[model samples]
Target: MNRNRRRGKKLSRALVTAAMLGDAGTARRLLRRGASPELPDAHGTTPLYAASVQGAADVVALLLAAGARPDTESGHGDEGTPLCAAACWGHAGTVRLLLAHGADPVLREDHGTGRAPLDWAERGPHPETALLLAAAVSSRPAAAP
Candidate 1:
């Protein structure tokens, strides 16, 4: 690979690490330095997805503001969309942030074998988060018959 592509990948890895650690400051620094918020790590986990899994609302908001797609899926099998990760971990606020940023509540992960965000929340036994996702799901317009 070319030097610039390699550098971009390196920066993306650093951003993902910062996001997982919930270090919003370092994430912000990396973003300012031109790290692509949408770029995925080797595991297909984007920085936003990492922050969502960590329930780092501040970092999530930053990444969203920096143009990270709220619905970006992560990992190969177990991890699905960012919303799925947040909901699975019972990260209510993170889930809410993702919803507000247009993350589809009904998206499934793991090649369609994984559960939707609401299903993840319910399975997580996070009653409040489940309720939140349920409401979001209910509020969406139904498909045309």
Candidate 2:
């Protein structure tokens, strides 16, 4: 493996580990130490995306605050965005955090899944999440709204 590839893998592992362990402080420390927030794992899963799917709100917040791009899509799984992953997993707080951080709710996966964040929200077991997504979709500007 080349040096850059090795470095990326190390960073990816660190971020994923921090996220999975729910250690927001450690994750932030890594970021401050120059770890790349956009680093992806072997499966192309970004730390932010993983944190969102796992419902780690503090991790998500720390990643975002440290400049993790909310709109970043995982290179695996049909280019799934953090918002979509969060919504699909019923992580209401993560979804809200992503949206508030400007995650595009209408983004579609590259796999032609037709699975927008709103779609995931609709399928959620949580009523509050469903309602929030429904209202958000309904309130979208229609080019002239």
* Highest lDDT scorer: 1
TM-score of each: 0.96, 0.86
Candidate 2 runs further than 4 Å off: 1-5, 111-113
Global lDDT of each candidate = 0.92, 0.81
Model 2 lDDT at residue 124: 71
Candidate 2: residue 57 Cα off by (Å)? 0.9
Q: Cα RMSD (Å) between model 2 and the true structure?
A: 2.4
TM-score of candidate 1 to 2 decimals: 0.96
lDDT of 1 by residue, 10-52 (tens): 9999999999999999999999999999999887888998999
> What is the total number of backbone clashes in candidate 1?
0
Using TM-score as the measure, the top candidate is 1
What lDDT, from 0 to 1, does candidate 2 have?
A: 0.81
